[model samples]
Target: MQGVDTVLNVLGSVCLLLWGVRMVRTGLTRAFGATLRRAISACARNRFTAFAGGVGLTGILQSSTATALLLASFASRGLIPLSIALAVMLGANVGTTLTAQVLSFNLGWVSPFMIAVGVIAFLSNSSDKARHLGRVAIGLGLMLLSLHLLEAAAAPLRASPAFVAVLSGLQDEYVLAVVFAAAATWFVHSSLSSVLLVMSFASSGIIEPKLGLALIIGANIGGAIAPYFDQSTTDVDARRVPLGNLITRVVIGAGLLCFLGPIHHWLAFIDPAPARLLVNFHTAFSLVAAIVFLPLNDPLAALCRRLVPSRPQADDPGRPRHLDPNVLDTPAEALACAMRETLNLGDKVADMLRQTMDALENNDARAVKAIEAADDAVDHLYEAIKLYLVQTSRNELGEEDGRRYVEILTFTTNLEHVGDIIDKNLMELATKKIKNRYSFSAEGTAELRAFHARVLENLRLALNVFTTRDITLARRLVAEKTSMREAEMHAGDSHFARLREGRPESIETSSIHMDVIRDLKRINGHLTTVAYPILEAAGELAETRLKPSDQTLMRAPAGS
Candidate 1:
């Protein structure tokens, strides 16, 4: 019963450690995420500054994996050079050891006071940023508190036969112990939590000093593994950063394994406290990794590039370039990626619109064929965007983020439908005109050309509105919808007048000319739909265009 209780108590402590670490990470990220991200990005001007930036960010957040993931996203976007990004990952490994170093201190007394102050500030503060900082304080307190609890939980192991036997097994099976810790860290996705537990175990005499060092080495290796797994679906540039970090860990971790015997002997003679032994090893290992790998970043990065050579995507523009899966954990970044991809998709549709018009004017079969080809690319992007968005954590998104998500999805869907209209309807119209060699009458040609120009102008405006989300421009787009309707009506009337005058070409092609006019108007209508959500969100859209029913009910004043 005592053994079972001891195991349960240790398990609970582990959970508390993880929760506290999570609170710190999420709180810090929520509070200063954007500024910190920019700092890292800007530091990429040089490999050394980039390295410092990684260390600084992970030192604050206490998670090097998070740093790696953020850098991976920047690399995926082509914003940061791959070499600089890999250097950041090297520094992140060193930064992660900060937690282990801090935990090694006897700061348990700080926990209760910090928790009290944190709760007071968190509850009293009105600003989200302040609250997030308060949350960070609370997480720090809990981490300290959990370490205290972990010390107490291991107390029972002092007398338990089962615990002693387990420790003995670990002594003989040190390699297996390393593997176990590595696997556990990978499962939890946190090396800090795992290493701290090993430190706690060693502090309480539940594990040998040599065993503790082995586990810490494993924790480092496992920590790098999770980020690599996360970036599996991203582009080679993104994957390469994590891959380079993993290689550093593997090489260093392997070397550390052989030296553990001698290091343990030397450290035990120098300062024999088991907890310090475990944590100091972790810190030393990481710092060495940073120092050794920092200078080799270029060669390492070159090697990574060679390993994960860029698959030339010149032919696959439809493939999503901005949707780095690593950043999906950061909702705002992911949404921004989706928005950029939408703009790219919109550009494809714009190309189609221009091509179709050129095909009409020049009687160019190739231009019409280009429109058809571009539509397929548009369809590819739409599916990729949908699937990419579906991967985002819906429940985690904020209110504005949720709204933006729907807007992006709706905009992409509308763009896809627009692509269909161009390929299926407009292409057929162009094909018919060219195959039958039915040229429009001069008056008819002039009207169709004018209508096509207006529609194309609106298409350009809609793209700007989608990208900038300028409510005034969106308002302009909505207003122009009515004007476009008026113009379409006028053009239709003009076509009939030409037909009724017994103009032979107009009479002969009356059906085709009117159909072309109707289709262009339809395209303009589709372009206008992009503005509806923007207007509705801004509270500028009226429920009905009709005057209030009360005006009708009361009747005009008798004076009128």
Candidate 2:
């Protein structure tokens, strides 16, 4: 009964500790999300800066996995390179060790005091900054309290003859110790938790010093598996970093085993006490691995490239399947990638609109065939982006990303609608014109072609705005919307005036001409729809009425 109670108490403490870590991480990320992103994006120019950025971000968030995942997302988006990502991943490993070091100290008494202050601040009508700080304090306190409880639970096990014998059974065999530690850590799904448990056992003399050291090594290996599993759903390029990490650990573990006798002798010299020796060994292994690998990052990346050869025609012009699942772990980068895909969708729709319009004006069957093919391509992209966004939104995302995900979904739907409007409305109209052998007068064909060119140009500009988030392009697009509307009205009036003049060709083609103008106007309206969100994303449209400027309208003609 006592043993069961002890185990339950330890389990409860671990649960509390995990909860506290989560709270602190969430609070800190919310407080500094934008600042951190700006800092990382600005400072990560070289390998060294990227490494430092990774360490700094992970140290602040207290989660190496979170930092590495963010870097991976950046790499996928072409914002960061694979070599820089490797450096960052190495730094993240060092940053995560800070948590263990903090827990090693005797800070149990401060836990309740931190919780009290945290609660008071949370309850008070304080500023957001103060509340955020309070949350951090509370998380730290809970973590310490949990560590204290974990230590206490293992205290009695030191005297248990059965526990000591179990430890003795695995002490000398390095392979067995590695397997046991890996199994235990894997089952827990937390390297930190497994390390803490090893520390508890070592501190209480329930596990031998050598066995504890082996467990620490095994925990590192096991912890790496989590990240690797995360990469499984991502692109093949994304799998390289985690695979590198796994290979590094396996090779290092093997080296440690080969030189165990000398390693133990050196460890004894550094820390005479067994429990301290175990902790020191864990720290030393990480430090040594980092130092040895840091300088060889470029070569390591090259090796990964060679091992995982790039696919032939990977960049062929089509829908990209590179929205790796590993990227979903970082919401900002995921949102950015989604936006890129949306822009690609816009481009496809624009192509279809242009081809369909050309077919209608020229009565060309080839143009209709081209538009139909483009429509199929646009449909595929739309489905891909919708599915990707659905999967991405399920992960932990910032407020802006959450909103952007919805916006991307909306934008894709609008682009898809534009495609449908072309195929069903414009394409069908063109087919009818061809079937009837209806020929427009030269003047009418020229005017309709001019209008088609303007709408297509506007669609292209809207796509650029979406892709680049360019405020300048966005503003210009808004201004062009007015010109487009004017053009539609002028075209309508001219078509009616020609009919009133009793021109035989104009009267014969009056209905088709009116339909083409209306559809062109609608297509331009959807093109404008893509731009408003771009302005909103750039924060230029927030509570600001931006009227079209005359100078903006005179910048360029359609297709220029």
For 64-131, candidate 1 gives per-residue lDDT tens digits of: 77888888888877889988887777777778888788888899999999898889989998766787
Spell out the clash pairs found in candidate 2.
Answer: none
Model 2 backbone overlap count: 0
Weakest lDDT window of 10 consecutive positions for candidate 2: 321-330
lDDT of 2 by residue, 1-560 (tens): 88788778877977887778767876676566667667768757887887787667777877665665566566656776777778777777776776777676667789999999998887793566577778888998888788788788878877777767887788787788888887776665567667777877777667777777788889878767766677777766667777666666666777776766677789899866665676677667666767887798888888877886766655434565545544453466667777877776776777677677568767799998888777878788888888888877776555667777776787788788888889888888899899998877777888898988888888788777766767898899989988988888888888878888888888878788888888888877877776787777667775845875888677858775
lDDT of each: 0.84, 0.75
Model number with the top lDDT? 1
TM-score of each: 0.86, 0.74
Model 2 segments more than 4 A misplaced: 1-12, 23-58, 73-88, 116-135, 152-173, 183-190, 259-275, 295-299, 316-341, 363-373, 376-409, 431-438, 457-514, 525-560
**Segments of candidate 1 deviating more than 4 angstroms:** 1-13, 42-48, 76-83, 106-109, 112-126, 148-167, 324-333, 359-369, 387-406, 431-439, 469-472, 501-512, 533-541, 548-551, 555-560
